[model samples]
Target: MKRAITGLLNRLRFKQKLFLSYLVVIIIPILVLGVYAYNQSKEMLRIQGIQGIVKNVDTISGSIDGSVERYNHAVQSIVLNKTFQKIVTNDYSDLVNLSYDLQEYLTPYFNMMVMLDQEIDDVKFYTQTYVPEYGDSVQSADRVKDEDWYQSALKGKGSQWFSDNGLIVVAAFPRFFSDKATNLVYMRINEASMFKNVAALAKDGTVAITNDRGDVIYSNQGATGERLEAGQLQGMKEGAIRIGGIESYLVKKTVKQTGWTIYFIVPAKELSRNAGSIINATLIVIAGCIVIVLIMIWMFSKTMIRRIYALNSVMKRVEIGDLSIRIRSESKDEIGELTNRFGSMLARLNDLIDELFRNKIVQKEAEFKALQWQMNPHFLYNTLSFINWKALRSDDADISRVVTTLSKFYRTGLNRGNNMIPVRDELEHVKSYIEIIQTMKDHSFDVEYDIDEAVFGHTTINFILQPLAENAIMHGIARKESGRGLLRISAKLSNGKVVFQVQDNGIGMPLETANTLLQNDSSGYGMKNVNERLRLKYSSDYSFTVESAVDRGTQMSIVIPAYLQS
Candidate 1:
């Protein structure tokens, strides 16, 4: 199965490969990321929503507890008042004056509390010091002593809460105000006014207030069958609550002083409902983004595939030596760079081909020259040999000896068909050429050799020495008059290499001109040919150098690696 799949992929073109690659590169990651982001965002927003709703519930709980606490302080304020305490005392016999004073004290206090908060329904003291007036809200001691608020206050020993009734603060005063009867101060608050903001913050939620005994005293959804049970809300400070086949988020807070638990009941799915639209909108945007991304990938990959196809076509043409083909692109992408480099390679390839053809033509000319070279020198040597033998017969010894040396020179110079020859043979060849030149120039130049005999067993490139000798004679020695011209040829072994130098005393050129020896060799067929041949055979490490000083002798040198027989 893997092999079949691999074969299928191998048959796909670059266009198909690029398109599929872009889909995998773009679509898969975006889809995965989109899914991950959607889930994470939904969870994060859900937590924030639950937190915000719970925070609002806690705020409402705080407000209710704070109002009741403020009432405790208000009630204590009138209780500690000296004049009102004295006026409301039972021992005061002037009934009209005492009652009038009592009315005066309590009326102003009542009006003040009523104006301060709507929760303040009324504030009253049921003290034993006072009797109830006609149509007054204050209760006499006999009618209210057994009341729940009064009983609770007595048990509490100070301020006490009967949330079903109100706050009852029943106290025993000293003999100065109430030695005979108990003094009681109570403040009744409106339940609806106290929990009004809870309704506002809850919106769609039910607000339930439960006492420490797990008894529900107040709920916004009064008498609803689906309301949270007291047992479910107990000890459940915060979390999801399930009851009666319904799920809800239960946010409960306790009023520490009153032992009252305030609950905000909300549907558990409310968080999801709030966040559903956002995740949906995100999914839609991501879907649109993916569509656009796929389109962009298709377009970009198509352009890439088209450019690659063009490059492939050019390569096919290049395979058959058609180097004129190329791809043109204005983009600064990798493909464009590849096409540019490929074009450069083709251009270089064409240049090398032209260079190779030119070098081959030069080689054929050199070979033709080698053939002519063999014929001309051999014919001259043979003619000279005949003349020398004839001259010897006639007893002309000097002429015969010179011609005999010339014969030997041409014979050894050819060196059978070998490019490499003995160093001694090269030296002898140079000697013969110099001897002939000396005779021709009327011995104007003198010849000197400092060759080591050890070098005779080693070999040198053939036909190398004769050209240097010719250059020394013609360019340096022959230019001078009389015995002033001198030619010296030397060869020695140095540091595992051979150094051959030809020095001449004549009209010497400047150092600047001597430094450009190889460059100037291009102007001469012999020097240029020898320089190219040496460079081709032995590389740039085997080279020539020319050194000269004005009015001094010039030296031309060749240095090459020495080869010893294994």
Candidate 2:
């Protein structure tokens, strides 16, 4: 019964795996993208909130400035009036009369001042001393000198405003008379009523004011007398600041006469509350998505685990030497492709395994036949040496010298069965080969060497240079219409390694062909053997580079191990 169940599982295939892969690939990316979008949207909303606060604060600053200008003009008019000055210079009987007459004359101005304060709410004046019937109370002359507004007004010939303070009169004082004998004038303001319009305009009703020295003069919510630290005040003219875990916008304007700074402050949260909705919505959507995704993951995992168990059962059948088990899938996807390819590969593997089992004797017979047909080069070398001896006996020195060079070339190439030798030995072998070629071609090549002596003994693969030299001469220079060529071989130490280069002044290869020679094995002629040897010795760090341009020339470089054989 277990074997029957196992056989049924083995027949199950690609559709299930493909569906799970699709879930992972598509659904996972969607979840990731949703999270990224959520974060980005939240940040954007935050920035927008800050900007809105700044904008609102800027508008409030302009309005405050306008109010300051109007208030300053009214004060200046009262101070510069010639009639009022005359009243100040007179004695009691005359001063009293003048005060009443001046009051009647200034009725229109007083009414206009009252109307202005109706929008802004409060204005008050304090004198140093009391006068009978000036109002209900006596503002003593001694108190004038100690008052900031009184002293500041007296010192100045023109009008000025001071930073907001908490001692606001809360009622409109328009143009009040100070009956003090002293020349000082004191003033007060009701900030809430004065900045009422500004508060009404607030999206979240956040605004405040500070003095030039960064003292909190007024806040919209009646918060007062707060002081900013010196470090916070430094280099701050007007901008934004983070306070009490919230960002606030600040704008400053100088009171022309008092030299006091007026600052408008608004909290970022209040100004950007509109944009806050966007953030909340984004977070909710992301959270919803996460919950949905978690549910999906749970479902997908359960289904995938079942499918994997089924596939594992089929795999065990094959592991136990059952080759007939096959995969079946209903969906077309990565899993389907994998199952189809695996089935095809199994068929091919079975064919190859059968072929090998049946032809073992034939393969051995072919190998022996190939070995029997091969000839050793030593026999040819001995025959050539015999000819050289005969030529030397006949007084043919040129023939004898060529034979000797050829013998030396073959001996060095064998190198006591070593696959690697010093670079110097390789160069000598190349030189000997070049000598023989020069003799045959009547010295049709100018070979230049720029080898570094310090790297002469570094080991390189045997016959690394000879084949390249032969190719440059035979297929390259010899094929050109001009029967002359320039072969330049350069080797140097660079960046802790030796770089070897061979450049020929022959017809260059096309860019495409040159690229193929370096990148593809099939396009490399003698290069295939060199590449295989290099791979056997080192890793991908070792390289062969070829640079060529049609009708220009070609340069080939080899980067090998720079160490001496230890």
Candidate 3:
């Protein structure tokens, strides 16, 4: 299966392969992580929402506790006042004195207490003494003696809290009052000021303050008049719960001072509402990233595939034997490098083809020229022998010698239509040519032969040394100024190779002229032809060099591998 998959992938183009790689290496992993992150974010937001609401409920509970504490302090102050106690317990004989004491001390004290706390709407004293009914401030104890809250306050040691008609009342019995009378001071607390914190929370969700009797004393949900059943809110301190058939989160705190519980109820959907937005935003970001990555992948694949396609086109052209195409790229990537290397290979291939054809043409030309010369070698040799016999019979020694030497030169040069010859035969051929040149130039130049015996065993290309000797005598020896030109011809074995040198102390040419002698074809079968012939025979192993200085001398050397005669 794995091999089948690999084969399938390998058949795809570069762009397709790149896209597939991106899908597996980049896109798929991103999508997986995005999904995981979205789920984690949703859970985190839900948990954080619950935590936030719990903190708000705790803050509101503390604020309500503080308000209730202040109100309690106010009630305690009134109960512990000695003057208020004396006034409530005094037996008055005149209504004028009773009214004077009530207006002078008790009214000012009550007004001061109310002024200090804005939540206190009113302060009233209920007594069974002969105190006149001083409006609501000094109410008769008989007015509320039978009232459950009043009775409770009289029997209770401390103050008792009561909720009545949208008001929070604190009823407390005065200290040291007459036992015959049930005197109490009750303070009216503004419900709005007392439950302001709970009201603030109501704007967001349902909030309620329930008393110990399971009666909701203050409900922002308009359920203040409703009563809860026993254990209705049990085990609902801080977690999700079902309220009125709707799933909601419940956070509850008890105010120790009032024995009332504050309940902050928020629907589960509402808490998760923000989580939805966060998840949506996260998904959008992930989608945007994926889109950008896809674009980049596409661009990268396009770039790479375009270069490959170009290379493919060039290769197709080459397949049809067209090797002249040129491709160029400026990129530093591996694809560009491959393209450059391919171009180099094509160039090298073209060079080898050209060199092979050139070598073949040179070999064919050499054979044709040899065949042209072979056609009349026997006839020319017979004619030259007849001329030598005639000169010998007439006593013309120079003519006989020239004719004899000419016959010898042609005899050795032809060598029975074979291109290979011994070193001794080639040297004899060159000696005959030199004899003819001396006869023509009147022996103007001196000649020397420094041949090594070791080189006699090796063979070289025929007719190569004759041209060098001719060039030396014509271009070097013939151009000498005053002194007789000295021509030196030497052959030796050096470093497993055969070396032939032709040198002359004649008027030498410039360095540039000497260098171009082997390159310029117009120089004619002298150095350039010999160099090409040596290369055809030995490739790059042979070396030919010309060294000369103006008016000094010229030296030409030919080096080839030492091939022994078989």
Q: Which candidate is the best by lDDT?
A: 3
Local accuracy of candidate 2 as per-residue lDDT tens digits, 72-115 = 66655665666544433343465657567546754445556667
Clashes of 1: 0
Write the residue-wise lDDT of candidate 1 on 37-63 in tens digits: 787787777787688777877788788
Model 2, residue pairs in steric clash: 13-328, 128-140, 128-141, 129-139, 129-140, 129-141, 150-185
What's the true lDDT of residue 158 in model 3?
A: 70
What TM-score number comes out for model 3? 0.43
Clashes counted in candidate 3 amount to: 0
TM-score of 1: 0.42
Q: Who is ahead in TM-score, 1 or 2?
A: 2
* lDDT for 227 (candidate 1): 57
Query: Each model's TM-score?
Result: 0.42, 0.46, 0.43
Q: Per model, state how many residue pairs clash.
A: 0, 7, 0
